[model samples]
Target: MPTKIEKDSYTGTDTTGHEWDGIKELNTPIPSWWVWVFVASIIFSIVYVILYPAIPLTDSATQGVLGWSQRDTLATELAVRDEGRADITASISEADAAIVEQDHTLRTFALRGGAAAFAENCAPCHGAGGGGRPGYPVLADDDWIWGGTLSAIQETIRVGIRSGHDDERYAEMPAFADMLPQGERIAIAHFVAGLTGKGDPAKAAAGAVPYQDNCASCHGEDGTAVEDTGAPSLNDAIWIYGSDTGSILKQISNPQHGVMPAWEGRLDPVTIKMLAIYVHNLGGGLQEDAGL
Candidate 1:
């Protein structure tokens, strides 16, 4: 028990009758506003518990009187949003991507929507701005291995290359390690490196014959690339692996065959169309009758 209960000199408040050492605690009443607030909080908690989920059960959470949930709220919001976009979505779904591109409004919508989709789905391998990573071709350039026309771009996005789809753009650059002699392949590598005008001249000249015999069938004789064969142009500076001699040699010995997943089944048609439009407008698109 306390030593004594008496009025304190400071502000004349009574002591709690509880003392520790020489100090005594004042038994001051709580402010009326504070007491009211505390009571109100307790009441609010009781009401909230009854009106909203407050307890956890074994299989599920408690179903409160209001029966409201964040899941339901989100579903309602999404429904409203989808309804608002119904007309535009329908128009995009119905129209061909080429036709959609003609309409300024549709093109604008597709570009914005495609950017969002690309960020989530295509940015991992293709890069955020379609700059492309190693083994992935740069989408922002005019060096498309397949083709760069709007229709061609759309088809590639739909079926993909070497993606196991029945209609896939299939082309296999044979590994020359087993087929060709080591010296001959090295000569060819030097020749390919020089095609971009940066390799050893002596080796490149010696490589010309061997390159003609083996590589000219797929990659053009001048290394201009055969689009039908999915061969990349060797004369340009847009090398996927590297522009170095070592990179060329490695590719000749064992090529890195890239695979792009088919978006036909994975994404809806409208989304695929928009993606093709977005990629085409990345400064690589060509006129329908234009040569690569």
Candidate 2:
């Protein structure tokens, strides 16, 4: 049932003739200011729709009266940025990596450009900061399998390791499990682990004989590794596969090699140069005077 409308005596306001206990409900009116704000919002929305995209359709939104688009704005901005960078990019192309590093403008441009390219391409395997994973070598550290010079890093990026490219850098260690007995393999594993001073010395002593006889040719007599052979150093704390004796034993049994993609044909020459410079600046690159 509808409540009858009446005037309340205590307050000069109209009330609905409905009472809860002794209190009557007041017929409150909406604020005039609020009503006007709501009307203004509706008008603004109509104006916005008329000036910019608003209505959605099957394939695209309605092209508004202004004839402007977000895509066009982005393209214009990118064109301006590229035009500004034309001279610096050309300088990077002509100069060597070391020469670029000496120039403030060229080095700054290369570092920023290289970081973007690395995130898109190299971050999947090498990590965002080049920390490396189980099979990948750390780029931020002093240790390197092939070398850590700028030229070395750049060349590796160009041809890649075991990539099947015509000029690819390739190296492989024979799986000793196919040739050696289990006992000798375990001994070699122990010896290799002990090179980092983390293995059982008792087993390591017995393992040394087998290690020298079979593994020392490429891994070196002291387990320091032969970089030319791409054999990782056992003497260092940095281990690409694993540092533990168990992982070492597994590798001794059946080695697993990693392959890097050749970027020479995939990336532009300038991009490749920038990527090389970026990697070299990651706190581990050797100077020209520093021999491998």
Candidate 3:
């Protein structure tokens, strides 16, 4: 199916001598506006090549009139950002314990920063939200194996629990099986369970003295925990290892020591403060809106 038109008609242009079903087609030149647009595009592309970095060379790109680079832009942005943080670093580092304790806005910002660092560094063991895993102590609860006080928490963060660091809170829960008779170990386990309202009274009464002598120094006088010693409260249902007889026996036989990384070097002081507050607020520490 082909169509043809007269050689010289509307615009004095030649037409093919062919037709399909008596229908003819005209051969007209491109419109003046369209032709001009096409030519302008080619010229604009050449100018663009000269103005911007569009052409690729052997090892580098063509240097345009404006020498712009992604690295330079990033560096400028980072410099501007760091300038702001630099001025605040002193105030943040020297922030009083009381100010951190009372200030909500400061606490919120610090917590957010700490949360990000915790997700990246502490989440592997403590979990993303400080919920804690099997061996890791839960930071999201009031049951801190160590003290829940801000200072105590900060010290713990600086030194770490059971760390060989000079100021680390040191005291291993002795394997009672080595010191006490097997029968007495059972009795103590029963006593410990009884403290948490899980064991018989008669057995617990017999093991009370042993519990006091062997466990009280760290676990507190009433099995309520010693924040200074990082000892868990036997009276509470929360157990670092487990609450079962077998678990208790194992704990009694071998002391459990869980390690948390000292975040001092890894994160800034302000960040650490924020994280401590964030974790403390999770379930353990003082709250602003709620009355005790």
Candidate 4:
């Protein structure tokens, strides 16, 4: 059993006076201010429990007077953002879809916007400035295997050549090795080179008849290119593939069929229109005053 010690009148406080031999224990009093603060804190806790979400219930937390929630806050923020974006979306549409890429201002807008979009989407294959990769076509020059006019380019973008579009531009440059003798193939290649002023006149004269029958369908009667056929003009010295003799010979032996994916379904109409205008203005845009 624990023994109770009487109060010491000298120290003026209650205590268990029993102690180790010759040592006395002292009783200390807490300050009034500290005690008052402790009491106030207890009272504040009680008030908080009643007015705010403090204790957990069976299925949910207690609802606070503020009525604040994370989910509700997010929803309100999204509504505000949508309201702000409405105008930008409307402006994109109002930029004119049928500008024909002739208006300088519209064309400039398209070029800037389209260049950004192209770098984001097409730089992996077409290069950052449409400078052509190992397999893709260059878009910065006048050389175009599939026409260069605004409508023509728009059509190409809508339905790519050799792509799975129903109305895609389609052509097959046959291998002369199978159709004509090796010498005749060489002669035709020489003729094509001559059209670009790069071949011997005698070889060109020798291959002229063969070139007229086989190559004229797309390259045109004078090798000037039939725009409707998507054949590049040979007289301009701008070769879509290459102008080197070896490259020409290889192309003559086995023609190239470049494929570009159709972006009509992938991009919106306004975006596609902008892209067409941008590409037209890159090197060869038909003037509005031109009877095109």
Per-model lDDT: 0.89, 0.88, 0.74, 0.73
What TM-score do all the candidates reach, one by one? 0.94, 0.83, 0.75, 0.65
Q: 165-273, model 4: which lDDT tens digit per residue?
A: 8887787677766777778777887888887788777877878898888888878878888866666776776676687656777888888877788887888766677
Write the number of the candidate with greater lDDT, choosing between 1 and 2: 1
What candidate 2 gets wrong by more than 4 Å, as runs, is 1-47
**How would you order the candidates by TM-score, starting with the best?**
1, 2, 3, 4
Decoy 1 TM-score against native: 0.94
Off by over 4 Å in 4: 1-85, 91-96, 100-109, 288-292
Candidate 1 residue 61 C-alpha distance from true site, Å: 1.9
Best candidate (score: TM-score): 1
Q: Residue 122 error for model 1, in Å?
A: 1.6
Stronger candidate by TM-score (1 vs 2): 1
Q: Which stretches of candidate 1 lie over 4 Å from their true place?
A: none
- Clash pairs for candidate 4: none
Model 4, residue 255: displacement in angstroms? 1.0
Each prediction's total of clashing residue pairs, residues at least 3 apart in sequence or on different chains, is: 0, 0, 0, 0
Local error of candidate 1 at residue 286 (angstroms): 2.3
Model 3 compared with the native: what TM-score?
A: 0.75
Q: Give the true-structure RMSD of model 3.
A: 4.9
